[model samples]
Structures are given as structure tokens and as C-alpha cells.
Target: MSRFLFISCLCTLLLACQHSPKKNYFYLSPISEKTVTQTSSNVSSQLIGIGPVDIAEYLTSSQIIDNQSDNTLTMSDNAYWAEPLDKSIARVVSLNLTQLNNGRSFVNFPWRSDSKPHYSLRLHVDTLSRTGKNANINATWELIDNDAKKSILRRNFLRSIPAESGAKGLAYAYSQLLAELSKEMDEALNQNP
Candidate 1:
């Protein structure tokens, strides 16, 4: 009886130790409805291609990253991104642009060869990390006039937004920053077009 009880207790302990913590996944949200509605009337028949968003090496991980200090970085084990961060950024930016400029056609990268766009937007993220209280994004974007075969606009954008607390909050902050960037891009496109 003693031996059986000892084995059962050990098995239970082992099973408890093997249990893993629940993981949380997060994705960036699109622009708010108010902003979308206000700008939705801006119509354009041009097709814009958004793609080839390049990000930093550290941001390639599926885990959410936090900057503990200026140099120290920490990646969350329990919090994860639902999709690739670069792809998410591109998707959100594309969605926000669509909302801000209704009637304008936007397609992501790798569109059908025959369905070429008039403008191509490319983004490169140099920094996208969150500290304890804020999240920061530094990036450069270029808009190419595919028909003209020339670069029309090249600009760098940097924003620091206050984050709430956890990984979810950081994700929200990032989304806001992307929306702002999209608005700026829309303004630029209107001017150029």
C-alpha cells in the first residue's frame, strides 16, 4: 500500500510539473471608425501596392519584445503574435489606408502579375520596441510611381506612444502609430496624385 501511494504521488507531481502556462496571442487593430468615416469620402481610382515591409532582426521573433532598458531587451514567453509582425504591420497599414481613402484600390505584395498598381509603397522599420511605459517606432517609407518609373516620395517617420501595461497594450499602441503613418501616407499620395 505504501509503495502504491508513493508512486501515485510522484506521478501526480510529475504531471503537475509538466503542465505549461497558457499563452496569449495578440494582433494589431485597424484605424478607428470615426477617422475612417471622416476620410472615407476621399476617392481615387488609382491602385496602390503595399508590400515588402522589412523589419529589424529582433522583431522577427513571434514573441512580443520589451525594452527593459536602452540596451536590454526582453521577449515575452507567454505572449505571442498571431501572425508575422512585418506582415501584420503591412496588413494594418493597408487596411487603414483603405479606410482613409475609400474608392482607392490597394493590394498587398505578390499581387497577380497582370494586376499591376500605379504606385508601390515600401517600408523599412529600423526600431519597433516597447519600454515599460511607452512604445516607439522608427521607420522609413518610399512611394514609387510605377508608371513613371521614378521615386515620388521618400520620408522617415518616428512616433512614441504611451502604452497601457502588458503586451496587449503595446500592440494597441503600435496599431495607433501605424494608423497615423497611414494617414500621413494618404496625404502625401493625394498631393502627388
Candidate 2:
């Protein structure tokens, strides 16, 4: 009886050790209304599309990456993105642009041809990673006039924001970076329009 009981306990322990913990999923959030600066309503009627937002190859994974040093990057095993990072970024940027521009209409990519937007914003993210105590983003963006089929404005942005110690902090920092980028884009549109 004792031998049988010992074997059963060992089996239970082994099974328990094999069970993996639940993964934590996170998503990028939009900027709060309080942080948004009100702009003139003249451009409210313009329909803008945010799309073709590309990210670095390393960021395509669902795993969140943290840069321990200049040379070391750690992909989190237990933390995951709720959706594709590139799509999330495009969605968040669209939302932010709507808030910043007040009555402006913004849509993510994949709109029907009949409802094409007047202007399209294209973004390419070179780097978006948490390094040490900061989250950094480097990107190049262009605004194209769809009617003329020409590029009007192009710019590059690099930003590093202080981040907290965990994945949540890193996500928040990235969100803030996007918000700042939206502001810059809004300014560019106002200048060109």
C-alpha cells in the first residue's frame, strides 16, 4: 500500500510541474482625450486613411521584446499581444488622429476603392523596443495626396520615453510614442493643407 501511494504522489507532482501558467495578453491603447490638442475644424471634412504601416521583422511576433542591453534582446515567453502589433498600431494611430483633429474622419487600411480617402498616411517602423528603462521608437512616414498621386510630406521620427519595469509599462510607452507621432502628423497636414 505504501509503495502504491508513493508512486501516485510522484505522478501527481510530475503532472503539476508539467502544467504551464496562463499567458498574459496586452494591447496598445489610444491616447487619452486630455492629452489631445484641439485643432481647427476646417479640415474636418477631409477623409484620411491610415495604412500601409509596416514594422520591423522582429516585431512581427506576438511575443513582447525587451532589450536588456545594446546587444541583448529578450522575447517574453509568458506575455503576448492580443492582436497583430502592426494592426494595433494602425488602429491606435487612427483613433489618436481622430481625437487630435476633432471632427476629422480616419480609417485604417483596407477600405473599399469606392470610398477611398483623400489623403493616405504611410508609416514604416524601424525600431520599437524597450531598452533598459526606456521604450524607443524610430519611424519614417509619408503623407500622399491620393487625387494627384504624389507625396506631399515625408518625415522621420525617433523617440525614447521612460518606461516602467514590466510589459505593461513598455506597452504604455509605445502608446505614448504613437500619440506624439500623431500630433506631428497632424501638424504636417495642417501645414500642407
Candidate 3:
């Protein structure tokens, strides 16, 4: 009787799961597509290298994170990132900056060994989470001028993105963050140069 009961219970659980909805996947997207290019005009531009986007360990997951409270988080197993969040963010940021000011040279990190960038941008993203209704990113970035061996810009930014429909909304919010950051970084570089 015990063996029969256990088998019946296991079969019922398996059948219930079969009726569950399929898992959904999400991917982060910046604005539009962009490519790193050479300057065609006589503009005083600095070679900017962007890299090493350090994200919070908790958020470094395939699943999208929802902040339930100040100290608690919920991960949706059915809704997840199509790719690693960190890599997507880096790609979006670099692409946004490159497109924001195409006149300037922008390169991803791990460039040629001999390449000497006039400036380098490093980012540390502390909060890239969603509340389901809104998305937010809080981060600090540093711009270092290698030629001068000094830091030109170190700014902390916090922005809220009004989003909906879960993962898509979060992706939009993330893209906006990149857009804002690129604009500010470009302006700062202009001021320093």
C-alpha cells in the first residue's frame, strides 16, 4: 500500500507540472544598432576604452531579479535573461556611447596590446534591479586619463525607469540608463578635453 501511494503521488505531481506555462526569456537592448568606427573629420577626439562592468553578484544570474524589499529578492524561473546580464549591459553601454558621438573613437576593452587610449571608462553597477512596475540602476563610473595619469570624472548616478510587462520593461529601463550615462560621459569628456 505504501509503495502504490508513493507512485501515485509522484505521477500526480508530474502531471501538474506538465500543465504549467512555458518559461519566457528576455534580452536587454539599448536604443539602436551602432558600430565603432574611425573619425572622418578633423575633430579632437580621445580614444575611449570601455570595459570591466562589475555587477552585483546577486544580479549576475540568468534569471531577472525582482526586489521584493530592501533586503529580499525574487528570481523568476519562468522569466530569465537570454544572455548574461553583465555582457549585455557592457555591449549596450559601448554601443550607446559609440552611436551618441560617432565622431569619437570608441573601443571595447581587450584591444590591441599596443593601443594606448587617451581615456578609459570603468563602471561599477550596484543596483540593476526591477520592482516590476519600475526599473532602476544605481552605479558609479570612473573616467581615467592615462596620458595624464589622473582621474577626470567619477560620478554616481541613480535613475528610475517607468516600466511594465515585466522583463521588457526592465530592458527598456536598462537601455535608458545607458543612454543617460553615455550622454553624460560624452559631455564630461568634452569638458576635460
Candidate 4:
């Protein structure tokens, strides 16, 4: 009967599909490298100060909230194409500071100062989120006068990064962002007396 033949063919097809091995693939595109811009060799030796950044205690476990809603995606899940909110950003900030100071002197936070410094830096990273085609980094940089207990310099730095599709792409974007931040910091410090 045609009905019997049709049922038999369906069962054979189902069995074949069930027996087929499942396949998983990860596609990563080639990431383009960006070059660092060279700045003038002239730099001041004034020892600037800095307080600890108030980043999330468990950055790796943190997530970025959706722009449309309060929904957050864990850094782990986002790691498929990019880095999470972990130590990577912190490390980038540290490197920027070191490079800015020219590696001569950098005082750690929880500072036990014997004397007042020329200027103290306090940073608050309010948001570091990723949108559809861009990553948004918003931060407040404050330069406090140790003796005055008041801010001498304050600026908000916001960077918009083109969305990266892969892990390498994410890294490349962060690197570029860090470089821009460093430039901004340098200019801020230079304007200070």
C-alpha cells in the first residue's frame, strides 16, 4: 500500500538522522592589528597620585546590561566573541598609568602618604557596555589636591568602539580604547600646574 510505503520511508529517514553525528563549529575571523601612535618624548617628571579604582569585586562574573533594558549578560557568555568585565580592563588601566608615569614611580592605593602629593587621581568606571555595533566605555577622572581636599581637574572620558565579532576583534578594540584613554590622561595632566 502507498500509505505503508510512505510510513516505512519516513522511519528510515528518521533513523538516519538520529544516527548522524552532531557537529559543532566556531568561526573566528582574522583580526586587523592597530598601530600605537607615538607621542613626543617630552614628559614632566612630576609625581602624580592615584587612588584605587572601584571596579566590581568579581569582575569576571560581572555582566553588561542591555541598552534597551536592565537585562545583563554574564562576562562568561559574552566571552564567546569578547572579553568579560574581569581583570583585563584593570590591567589596561594599570599599564596606561605606568606608561604615563614612565615607570619611575607609582604609589598603590590605600595610600599611606608621609606627605601630600602634587595631585591625586581617583577614577570611577561607571559603565563599560557593549551595544550592537559598538562598545561604550564611560568613566570619570578626578584629580584631587591632597591638601585642599578638592578636585582640581575633572573630566569624563567616553569612548565608542566599533563592535568586534570575535575574541581577537574584541582585544583589538580594547587596545585602541586604552590608547585613546592614555592620550586623554596625558593631556589632562599636562594642563595641570
The local distance difference test score of each candidate is: 0.86, 0.88, 0.76, 0.57
Residue 82 C-alpha lDDT in model 2: 94
> Candidate 2's residue-wise lDDT over 4-23, tens digit each?
99999999999998896889
Error of 3 at 67 (Å): 3.2
lDDT of 2: 0.88
Tens digit of lDDT per residue, candidate 4, span 84-182? 443345445545655644522445455675744667677776665556657667778787887788988788989998966644455556566656765
In order of appearance, the predictions have TM-scores of 0.87, 0.88, 0.78, 0.60
Choose 3 or 4, whichever is better by TM-score: 3
TM-score winner between candidates 1 and 4? 1
RMSD of 1: 3.1
Candidate 4 or 3, higher lDDT: 3
Q: Model 4: clashing residue pairs?
A: none
Q: Could you tell me which 10 consecutive residues in candidate 2 have the lowest summed lDDT?
A: 35-44
For candidate 2, give the lDDT of residue 105.
86
Q: Give the poorly placed runs of model 1, Cα more than 4 Å off.
A: 1-18, 38-44
Q: Write candidate 3's Cα lDDT for 110-153 as tens digits.
A: 66768868788888899887765777889998998878888878
Candidate 3, residue 145: Cα displacement in angstroms equals: 1.2
